[model samples]
Target: AQSVTQLDSHVSVSEGTPVLLRCNYSSSYSPSLFWYVQHPNKGLQLLLKYTSAATLVKGINGFEAEFKKSETSFHLTKPSAHMSDAAEYFCVVSRNTDKLIFGTGTRLQVFP
Candidate 1:
């Protein structure tokens, strides 16, 4: 079975500063990882994904994550933060032919 754990349940960041959301995973086979963001009472938007591709994967809106096989980690990072970026983030993991396993979710609160 494949599973994903988001280490932080809530993260607060100041506007214009960097943002980091930690995530870890466990999988029986090679996995495909993804990051998705959700706004208040809205659907999820796919931020980025790693599918046996590059370890350092870049996403939209200046967000990026590095997949580290040795550490079993896929940590999301952003060079700068914006108020609009304040949303719930989820770390997902799955196999090519398997269903997705979603993390508990990390809520980001951005302050001016």
Candidate 2:
């Protein structure tokens, strides 16, 4: 079985400051990890994904995440945050055709 834990339930950042959302995952086999964001009244958007290929995966909106097998971590990071970046973030994991496992989610609050 695979599962993900979002270390922080909420993260607050000032506009233009860096943003970091921590996530830890457990999987029986190689996992495919993903980060998705959802703004108020909006559908979920794919932020980034990590397959078996590259450890460091980049995605839309200047967001990226690195897969660290050694640490069992796949943390999301952005150099700077925008007011529009405020949303709920989810960490998902899947393994070999299995159903996606989602984290509890982290709410990001960006203040201007």
Candidate 2 per-residue lDDT over residues 1-112, each given as its tens digit: 8899999999999999999999999998899999999898899888998989999999999999999999999999999999989999999999767777899999999999
**Candidate 1: deviation at residue 43, Å?**
0.3
lDDT of each: 0.96, 0.95
> In terms of lDDT, which candidate is strongest?
1
Candidate 1 per-residue lDDT over residues 1-21, each given as its tens digit: 889999999999999999999
Worst 10 residues of 1 by lDDT: 92-101
lDDT of 2: 0.95
Q: Estimate candidate 2's RMSD in Å.
A: 0.8
Model 1: how far residue 54 lies from native, Å: 0.5
